[model samples]
Target: MARKKSPTLTEAELRLMEVLWQRGEATVAEVVEALPKRLALAYSTVLTTMRILEQKGYVRHTEEGRAYVYHPLIDRNQARRSAVQYVVSRFFNNSPELLMLNILENEAIDADELERLKAMIKNAQEDGSEQL
Candidate 1:
């Protein structure tokens, strides 16, 4: 059976969205150009991906001359939050603490980064807001 389409951005779609987020708006050709050299996606591929993003409500396009200039409907932070929530739901079993613990155990976090994380945790504790 065919897999269902996910609302979350795929890797290719995220790459395209990153270009749109950075540039504010861009044509398919421009997005193709902005992508990493190693990605080597064709203009047609970028075009199709942008259309998919539009259908997913992540982007919108306007007719600019002969080309469609696509703009991100969602901001970078919104995308990040959604992606994190999806990860927390799927792999972390709806437990953000498990996600944090997994990262802390496996990842090599430096002292400065650890301090920053601690500060953020402290702030969160002070606020007493567990609504994630």
Candidate 2:
């Protein structure tokens, strides 16, 4: 049976997409080259993954000479937002607050980072009050 296409990018797909997002466009060889030596992804593996990304509508390709130059259809920020929404829906009962709370509780946040988060929350509350 055929596997269902995931709405969100897989880890492998995200790795390739990060390369595309950084470079703007690249051929399969370029992507393989850009990846860290630790990953050790083969040219064929990168090519196949790029094709999967195309099928998932996250990337498009143009034929340039003998190579197919692939470009990201979505930007990094858009992908991040989609990933966060997916996590919220799948693991937090669709509540972004729950997701935020989990991160605050489980992660070791620095004091400066915690202050920034509190400031952002304060700004959000002010914005909400202004809306009313």
lDDT against the true structure, per candidate, is 0.91, 0.95
How far out, in Å, is residue 20 in model 2? Answer: 1.0
lDDT tens per residue, model 1, 62-82: 998998999999998998899
- By lDDT, the best candidate is 2
lDDT of 2 at 51: 93
In angstroms, the error of model 1 at 112 is 2.1
Poorly placed runs, candidate 1 (over 4 Å): 129-132
lDDT of 2 by residue, 1-132 (tens): 998888899999999999999999999999999999999999999999899999989999999999999999999899989988999999999999999999989999999999999999999999999999
Q: C-alpha displacement of 123 in model 1, angstroms? A: 1.0
How high is each candidate's TM-score?
A: 0.87, 0.89
Local error of candidate 1 at 27, Å? 1.1
